[model samples]
Target: MPHIAVIGGGPAGLRAAEILAEAGHGVTVFDQKPSFGRKFLMAGRGGLNLTHSEPAPDFLKKYGAAETLMARAFERFSPKDLVEWCHGMGLKTFVGTSGRVYPETMKASPLLRAWLKRLDGLGVRFCPRHRWQGWEGDALVFQTSTGEAVRFTPDATLIALGGASWPHLGSDGQWANIFGKADIALSPFRPANCGFLVSWSEIFRTKHAGEPLKPVTLSFAGNEKRGEVMITEKGVEGSLIYAFGAALRDAIEAKGKADITLDLRPDLSQEALLKRLSAPRGSQSFSNFLRKASGLSPLALSLLREGQKDLPLDPEVLAARIKAMPLALTGTAPLARAISTAGGVRLDAVDDHLMLKARPGVFVAGEMLDWEAPTGGYLLQGCFSTAAIAAEGIKAFLAPA
Candidate 1:
């Protein structure tokens, strides 16, 4: 039997190992972390969003520029296939109101435990704290936790070391430089699904930091996302901002700053808001009156105040401002703080099988590839789908023709 070595214990590497081990190959998964799935567990702290329930066509669109490349992988293991795979592991899943799929327990622990157990039964081995350090004359080299070096020469190897996001969880994107030495094409990593920095007033930052603006609409570059965003000490972040992260990041990169519009009262029309603001201001303070009239939260009001020193008392002006308040994003959160990363091994560097054309039998998958998707379960789906595709490529490579 051919021996296969899988580097990085992320979802993509694990999935690839499972497929190879089940196909009768001797497989060993190596990771620098003390345990596997540290990042996966962290991601599921709130709730494990496994995949989206959106149709294949619409779901594919979430991948943005990588949609075409990812479509090929999704053709084999799609959202439906992912759900079924979970079911096969005895883990039942349900779709949330927003179409995100999660296990019954809404935690990743149980599912990961079951998966590890299954791989154990299939004779797969895991070597933890073994960090991959570039190759030594076609032999894979790793540095042990105790500062010892180890080497292995497997029949095949798959690299799924995730992106630059959540570096503390193990994936720090150091592989880019390693592969670059091998003459492999790589795109520099950038923050994705990340927050942007806004020069908030000290008063607003001190008061509204960490406060959430719910039921708000954020529009950028012709794209709009209706969700909630949290005001950070530096700027704003959360679901709504993440949806436009790539565009916002690019805009800031091109123009030095991005001008975004926030609809504080998306449900209320300008006319309705104008009528409400036209109401007489009695003994009630302006804050109290605006809150009752427009249903704006304290955080929303603070955000409004951030835009201008003094809000317009005129109903028309106030209504128009309320309808579309401008916010300027100066910069994106650091790549380390981003939810995920964009840019990686360019698609052209890898063949259709995801194997690096310059280095045959070395396949790449997951976030390490030059593809990115917004949050909302698309990231996990992309990881799993690409892992399956790469695993198939490995299997075909090892099989006798």
Candidate 2:
């Protein structure tokens, strides 16, 4: 059996290790961290979203520019395949109202534990705290926890080191330097599915920071998403904002800023809102009167006011403002704090099977590749699908006739 080395123990690395080991290859999984899945566990803290239940076409579009590259991987292991894989490991999964899939237990610990046990049963060896340095001749070099450098010569290698995000979780994008030194083509990393910075006034920041705006719709670049968003001390984040993260980040990069329109009351038509606002207010304060009329929470009211210096008295103007509150995002949050990142090894650097064309037998998978997707279960699904494709590539490369 061919001895294969799978580097980086995120979802992609671990999943590829499982596949290669089960295929009767000698697989060794290595991770820089002491544990195998730090980010995976962190992702589960907010009810692990495993994958989405959307149709393949819609799901594939989330990858944006990399849709063509991801299409092949999905054919090898789609979201439905991922769900079945979870079931095969004795874990039950359910689809959320938003169509995102989650484990029945709603946590990653159980699923991770079961997965590790299966890999162990398959005789897969793990080397934790093995920080990959670079190539030493034809052998891979690693710095162990003890600061001792070691070398390994494997029949093939699969790299699944994640992109530059959540540095504390071990995906620091330091691998880019090594790959660059190796003359491999790469794309600069940028924060994705992250918050955008908004210059909030002192009063607005003080009052609404850390609050949530719900049942709202945000429109930008001709795309709209209706969900909840959180107002951070620095800017805005959460599921709603993340849907437009890539576009906003790109716009800010090119034009120094991006403007998005937020509908504070998506459920209410502007005309209906105007009719309600036209109602006579007796002794009640204007704030209370508007609050009751629009049925907006204090957070939504504050956000609406952020765009308008003074709440308009004209019912039509106020209704229009409530329906479309413009927000200017100055920049994106720091890469370290971003939930995920885009741009890595250029897809052109890898063949259709995910093997690096320049370096035969070296396969790339997961976020390490150039593709990126939004937060809503797409990230994990992308990792799994790519890993599966790379594993098949490794098998083909190892046992060529």
Candidate 3:
């Protein structure tokens, strides 16, 4: 049996290890952290969103520019396949109303525990605190927790070091430098699914910061997403903001900033909203009247006022402002603070099976690849799907002629 080294004990690495080990290969998973799946556990703190329930075609669309490569990955292992794999481990899964899938336990611990147990049963080895340090000739070098350097020569390798997000959880992006030294092409990492900064007035920041503006539609460029947005001291965030994260981040990189429009009442037509605003105040204060007429929360009203201090008296103008309130995003939260990362090994840098073109016998998967999707289960699915492709590539590479 050929010895395979799997670096980075993330979802991708672990999944690949399981597959390779099941094929009767000797597989060892190495991680910098003392334990595996730290970030996965953090992600599951709220709820472990495994994969999306949308049609495979629609789910593939979320990968954006890397759809071609992701298409190949999904062909090998799609979302439905992913859920079935979970069930194979005796983990029950349910589809959310938003079309996102989650284990019935709603926690990553149970699933991860079961997965690790399965891998161990398949004769996979786990090596914690072994930080990969590029390569020494054809041998892989790792610095153990005790500061001792160890080298291992394997028939094949799969790297899934993740992206630069959540550094404390083991994805610190330091691997970029190592790959760079080896002449492996990679893109500069950027924040994805992250919050953006805005210059909010002191009063608004103080009063509305940390408040949630729900059932709001956020429009950026030509894309629109309806969800809840959290008001932060720096600007706005949450699922709605994350939907436009890539576009907004790229726009900010090209230009100085990106501007997004927030529709407080997406359900109401402008004409109907105007008609409602035309109602007589009848001794009600301007704020009270606007609040009652627009059916907007106090936080929403305050956000509207942030655009223009003096409320417009014209019902039509007020209605238009409510329908499309522009908010400027100055910058994105730091990569460490982001939910995920964008920009990694470019698509063309890897072969059809996700083996690195510059480094044959070595494959890449998960966030290490240059692809990003929104938070709703797409991230994990991308990781798993690509891992399946990489494992296939490794198995093919090691096959005896």
Estimate the Cα RMSD of every predicted model relative to the unseen true structure: 1.0, 1.0, 1.1
Question: For model 2, how does the per-residue alpha-carbon lDDT over 233-270 read when each residue is reduced to its tens digit?
Answer: 99999989888888899899999999999899999899
Segments of candidate 2 deviating more than 4 angstroms: none
Q: Could you tell me how far off, in angstroms, the CA of residue 164 lies in candidate 3 after the best superposition? A: 0.6
Ranking by lDDT: 3, 2, 1
* Cα-based lDDT for every prediction: 0.91, 0.92, 0.93
Q: Which predicted model would earn the best lDDT?
A: 3
TM-scores, one per candidate: 0.98, 0.98, 0.98
The CA root-mean-square deviation of candidate 1, after full C-alpha superposition on the true structure, stands at 1.0
Deviation in Å, model 1, residue 135 alpha carbon: 0.8
Clash totals, every prediction = 0, 0, 0
Writing each residue's lDDT as its tens digit, candidate 3 over 1-401 gives 79999999999999999999999999999999999999889999999999999887888888899898889999888999999999998999999889889999999999999999999999999999999998998999999999999999999999999999999999999999999988888888999999999999999999888999988999988888899999999987898888888889999999989988989999999999999999898999988899999999888888889957598999999999999998999999888999999998988899998999999999999999999999999999999999999999999999988
- Tens digit of lDDT per residue, candidate 1, span 1-401? 89999999988999989988989999999999999999899999999999999888999988888898789999868889899999999999999999899999999999999999999999999999999999998899999999999999999999999999999999899989899999999999999999889999889988888888989888877888799988899998998888888888999999999999989999999999999999999899987898899888878887788758688888898888888999999999899999999999999999988999999999999999988888899999999999999999998888789
Give the range where candidate 2 is weakest over 10 consecutive residues by summed lDDT.
Answer: 302-311
Error of 3 at 97 (Å): 1.0
